[model samples]
Target chain A: MKANLTIISILAILFSSCYKDKGNYDYAALNKLEIKDKNGVINISIIFGDTLRLSPEITQTTAQNEENLTFEWMVFDNSPASSYALPKTVIATTRNLAVQITEPPFVLSQNYRLTYKVTDKRTGVSSFLFYNLTIINKYAQGWIFLEDKGGAGDFSMLLPNGTVEYNVYSSLNSAAPMSKPVKLEITPFQITDDMSPSSKKIYLLTETDGMEVSYQTMQKKFNYGFLFYAAPQIIKPTRHTWVSTSTSATLSGSLGVVVNDGKVHTNLVGGFPGSKKWGASLLSPAGNLNYITAPFVAGGTTYTAAVYDVLNKRFYSVGNTVLSAFPSTASTVFDMNNVGMDLLYLDSANVVREYNAVFKDETNTPYLLKFKTVSTTGAPNLTLLKTQMNAPDIVNMTAAASSTLTPHIYYGVGNKLYRYETTSNTTFPQFTFPAGETVTKLKFSRQPLGTSQLAAVTWTGTESKVYFFDVSNVGDFTTYTNVYSGFARIVDLGYKVP
Target chain B: MRSYIYYFLLLTAILAACGKDNRVMYKEDPRIYFSKFATNPDSTDYSFGVKPVGLLTDTAYLTFRIMGTAVDKDREIKVTIADSSKAKAGYHYNLGPLVMPANAYEVRVPVYLYRKPGLKDSIVTIDFTIEESKDFKPGYNDKPGLNVYDRLHYKISLNDQLLKPASWDSRLALSFGVYSKTKFNFMIVTTGKTDWNSTIFPGDQNFLIQTVKLSLYNYEQANGPMLDENGVRVVFP
Candidate 1:
């Protein structure tokens, strides 16, 4: 009984010591700050490279004189903190924040924590207002049109919302102008030694030069010479193509083929965050004869690309380090080593392992040759259909593009567009432009996850315009989706996707 | 009152155990060993065959790292050739003065090798050992299970005959084609590079090939066709 009484007495004493104490003290309330945009919202979104202007309505309950308070605006990357410290940038010291957002754009919209601190110099008290900011890339998703203005050229972007951003290349790369544009290529995912993780790369090819630019800023990354283990003697680059196959769920292995001076060079497209340089000129080792190849190449996931040798009028397969001739087989549909015709256009057809090539004989007769670049057993199989085109306007076609989802080849003659079915050897007239308008280039969107749309550029005497047509599963132009005008003779167009 | 004393004693013990630990974990003596590069930890090899015929001597550097903290005073390192070495120290090679500067964790020792007449017909190897000095003692030995070699020892081979580069077949062959001694010598003369290794970038390889191709064309135009040691017509792929 005595022990219990003693414990209870101690507990009572402790409870008595924890009693709230009210003392005579003088206290002052802190300055309360409220910050908001004109729409009364604290969170905002802006595009990369655009100026961010925020004249928030800041209210302080305790401070009436603006000169007695100082303001500071700071921004921090809202990504989860890593082992290394994250960077915090002080953007402005004035009450109104105005600064250019030059930070790198992420693949997705990046979140940033914007903080506005208002300090009262009199009492050394401060108030803070926080904002959630999102930054988006201007070049995230669009159609890049290369405009050729005589010898000098520029690039324009046709956004999905029917808006055109003209001369985007010149606006971004003012000092480094593009000239004699040849081709435009977009690498959905590219990793280099200097870039961590992966990034999208845009390749701008010209007659005498080749350049790689950032997909986000359109800023030049490197020139054509940097693309090779050793650049060729001639600087005439005709085409650069990339083909990749997923090696794992999160990793892909790619191969790059560059055709310069009518010679083919190849390299492993990208390393897992490493640099890959093109190898030597791929030529037949059996002969000491000089070789010249066509500009167009058909690439596949088998780490090999097919190029047509113009001098010998034959097809050659280029691997990582060697150029090899397709094995001659009597059962083959056509002799790969003796096509005997000049290759006009060569591209991968919609079917897997199948390629469509258009060739013209000396008599001006156009022939459509459809063959599998590689067979199921990893051997060259030229056993598919090969027939002479019966369409009268086929020989007059100047531009050609192949579909990826259907075995259809879209060709342009003057101002008319036609689709040729390789399986049925039939041609169908798709569309016709106004008088004096001539088709200059034709391309199909090659984005892996994008819709199958055919993009055609036409020069209408005074200006150039691009037309997008939605393609049906039956290889027909179902609808005219969009059209963008006001370009300077667009030479090539490619779809850029995040 | 007794329970209060017990509570106070327990709190005192908990606070006493919160003191910082200052235990030493490293040995007091400083040690040094031959450092291995991240790219290549094995012994290095050199050949005068890649150099111009007129060149007679070249220098190679062997690096050493210390296992202790850097000091503010310069120290001398002692190096000696193994008794079983095939190359004579004074006749075929000479060791430069070895000095590790103050506040440095690593130092490079230069070995000057000569193109002796015997080296043209036969390869010579010099095995080096790091000896104890006033500042440092020989450090890590071989760890066979870990595939690591002795850090206290290093070896270098010297030859005057044209030897094929390691990357000849896998990398250079595609650009330069077949490999031959005469072709390699001509490439050295054309590119003026004595250090041809596997680490050449693709762009550099292309540049080298282009440079040599042009030079080869010029040479053949001036002097019929160049032939290799086997009498094969030298050609670039």
Candidate 2:
């Protein structure tokens, strides 16, 4: 019996080995598939209104039946970046064997996942191929509102969509190289000019750095900063401006820099970091609290800019030859941040003043103590424009976007929104928000199609909302088109120049 | 033996029937909410509470309810008043010292409203949210939805308006008047209807109502409604 058991064991082992060993495995028989055109980074740069078409060749093993299969192509935001864009749900899907592209958010470049899932209907076997689609920006030309997300700010791109797109920066620049969520408190961004497409493109000014974005492509641009891949060198300047004629790359723009380095200097041409080279030109004598007043050119060459020493409360003009007291004000220029040569200051009685360069009669300022064109006192002709009871505690002046009507320049005075009409040289009440609402920031945006509208950000202790009033006609002041909202206590606002 | 088995079976059935899903059914979790889900308050959607005017010592409870397994020790929950809320912290009213005792389901926040006599128009609102605290989490709402919605917070609208704004249109709500509390309530409640609301778009039906608020108030007074409703105070033109 023992001998029989041994023989039987040997025989069983031989049979099992024979059953397990089915000769050399054939690689061709395995279910295998490959995406033929899946080479290089999956990023595709597409111009606005341009159609994108791609059909990848799927190669499968001859032994695997590839004739009957199911396919699903989907696109969704796959960014784990909270500092950047909004909630990205599935924007598009296709069941065809090929990939068909659709209209992307034109405000900024969107990070999308183009997926191809192929399933063998007969065997229930499936394979998936994913390509990261970087839709390079194409049309960011409009009012780009920014959200000061404390540490990591959020951006909204209102395309010339007649109004604006909310929180567009996250979508526009989140995936670009050198992209990072902020690690510090971010103030509201600033733009130094009225953007003109051919002459100016919007350049957002930040405390830490600067960013230049394409108006047509909406694709954000970066430059060779002090740190090639980190913050721009333009950080920490108390204030900066483009001294050049226009901000367009085609235009040569000089930069005005006022730093606490105890000096007032100007940099080479261009408003944004990309065009602003690593250089500086002194504008004032050192050791003074130099505050650079914006340049004012009365529609001609030889514009004038002044430097105010807050410590001494004096003004000195910056010219092609020398930095001296502006031909108008010697030592009487009040430290001022202007609204188009119009200074906003609280008088001794704390009355809000929108002091513009108006032709005030002999009644005010006894004559022209100091000022530019229009009067003996180019000094701001400030009138008590806001005295509303429910007006919020004014934070400060934000941007001055023009009105559609003859009157331009909007002020976010607490809860009350005031408009200054250069036509009448008068500031009138534009919109008086219901009580409890505070206008945090106001800006004027010039849409690509030419809509001179003023946008305002209002905070309701509980929420932040945006409103746009068509300034084309003063009679339409009461009603406004609330454009977009859901922002942090707004820090600042600016309209895209071009 | 058969009778004994019957008794055992009956006892088992009774226990099964009596067993409760003691787990509090929270709308969302890790956070406390201001709602009527588990509370015993009258379902007035008192989400918008209206207190009578001229009541000097009037106090309304902004009861916030939370559902989950109640804790064993009294826990303190911190609530934050959004920076957007214009209400004063101490002068107008006082908040906090909010407590959800062990084995408790909700916390009733006491808001003592102040009223100065002869004030014809007044609308004050208190907007507060449950700040993330060690005691509890704010909320976790992964519910699939649309059109159907729910809130775990409260906004007390103290007013003397003849008709509380029921319109979902922000412009129409604003047209009612300058009552801060009322307008605030209208803005927060009818967010989707306001074009400024980033959350609602494309499908929001109440958006069209804003045109009325935008029309030059004088123009509306001159031309009435641009789209007249035969006789209805021209909803908005």
Highest-scoring model, DockQ: 1
Task: List, for all models, the DockQ compared with the true complex.
Answer: 0.17, 0.01
Model 2 chain A: which ten-residue window has the lowest total lDDT?
A346-355
For all candidates in order, the CA lDDT equals 0.76, 0.45
How high is the TM-score of chain B in model 1? 0.76
* TM-score, every prediction: 0.76, 0.37
- Report the lDDT tens digits of candidate 1 across residue range A160-219: 676789988899789998889988877765544233234656778898998888665677
Give candidate 2's whole-model lDDT: 0.45
Q: In candidate 2, residue A293 scores what lDDT?
A: 39
Docking class of 2: incorrect
Tell me the TM-score of model 2.
0.37
Q: Model 1, B1-237: lDDT tens per residue? A: 776665576567657889999997966678888887534444767998777789999898888888888899998888788887899988889988788889999988788999999988898989888899988888777642322357888888899888888768887787888999899989988777876753665545554665676567668768988999999999887
Give the range of the ten consecutive residues with the poorest summed lDDT in model 1 chain B: B141-150
